[model samples]
Target: MATISTLSDLYISELKDLWSANDQMARALKKITPQATNAKLSQLLEEAQTGIADHTQLLKALIANQGEEVSKEHCKGMEGLVSEALKHVLEQPPQNGPVLDALIIAQYQRMTHYGITGFGTVAAFANALQMEDDGRQLKDAVDDLYDADELMSELAEAAVNREAAEE
Candidate 1:
């Protein structure tokens, strides 16, 4: 944890944090994706893992592009979120069915919302520092994360929730 005196320092630091976050979420997803009985939810989790990896690579590349050390500080923020997600869906998970799927959606959204905030904030930081290319790339990552979040919401509203309610 280095002192962040400049906007560039903050931006690069946030990027590293996001990289750690993506890695944590990726590992958590691997543990829980198979717990999803709903095919759609499982599929979404699979796709999200790939996207997270891609975003992690982007974070690394962005840090290197800034001539930074290309290393990540452990993201305690995401550490907590992943902890809660696993506790909710794995440590004491719901039954392996629609109910579980709904719970998974809820937990997944919580993590994604964290990601959305982090990435969006970093994008803004990049723009504030006049790094338009980094800003655009990060904004694109935000969009990808948001799209995944939205699809989970749609899946929940259209199917998972209803099925869980009937359960």
Candidate 2:
């Protein structure tokens, strides 16, 4: 992590941390997305990977715009989240079909929530630092993650959960 002596240092450090988080989440999604059986869930997972990539690019641009190298600090918070996701979905495979789909949603949402929190934090930091454009961009990213989470909830309530219960 950067020294973080000032708010500027902290803001840049967070950007780097989030960059690493996105990379970790994206990789985990790549492996986990295939495990999703529901067509919509699969599609959402694919789109999420793309979204993560986009967010990563935004983080890089933010870092560069801040006059820093587009480097990243390893985000241990996301590392733990990704590890839990893998543990539930891959390391100890859930039963396939709706049950696995349900598990996938649970794991995916957990990671999504983490991203939301992290991005939201940095967005506030950006705004406090008077980096309005960067703050707005980060907040927009948070909104996207929230939308994804809502869709996952809708999927669970509309079908996945019921299907899992029936199984």
Candidate 3:
């Protein structure tokens, strides 16, 4: 990693971090989706995988535009979160259906929140750099992530939590 001597350096670093985070999230979603007992939760996880792929491409293009090599530094934050989620899934007893789905939703929300913050931070950096188009693009991605998070919340409140309570 390079020293952050300027805002541009910080911006590039953030872009790289997001790239790594998205890659980690893609793998996590694959593992999580199959464990979800709720059909809607499973579908949402699949859709999020596609969104992560698209966002990764966008991050690469943004980095390349800045004359930086398209490479990612490993994001330890995301790595830890993913590892914790996997631990939860693996360590828990296998008989609980709704309870497991509820846990998955919680874990999914944590990952989405990380993405929301990362994209929002990059968008702010873009705005500071006077790159309006880049800022708008990052903001759009942030909005999509927020929408997914909201949908997950609704799913949890409407069905998953209730089912889990019965378990």
List model 1 lDDT by residue over 10-72, tens digit each: 998899999999999999999999899989889999999999999999999999998989899
| Candidate 3 TM-score to native | 0.97
Candidate 2 error regions (>4 Å): none
Model 2 — which ten-residue stretch has the worst lDDT?
A: 88-97
lDDT: worst 10-residue window of model 3: 87-96
Q: How do the predictions measure up, each by TM-score?
A: 0.98, 0.97, 0.97
Q: What is the per-residue lDDT of model 3 for residues 1-167, given as tens digits with 9 covering 90 to 100?
A: 99999999999999999999999989988988888889999999999999999999999999999999999989999999999888887566346889998899999999999999999999999999999999999999999999999999999999999999987
Tens-place lDDT per residue, model 2, 46-95, is: 99999999999999999999899889999999999899899989888766
- Two-way TM-score contest, 1 vs 3, winner: 1
| lDDT for position 167 in model 2 | 83
Give the backbone clash total of model 3. Answer: 0
What would you estimate as the lDDT of candidate 3?
0.93
The lDDT for every candidate, in the order shown, is 0.93, 0.94, 0.93
Instruction: For model 2, name the residue pairs that clash.
Output: none
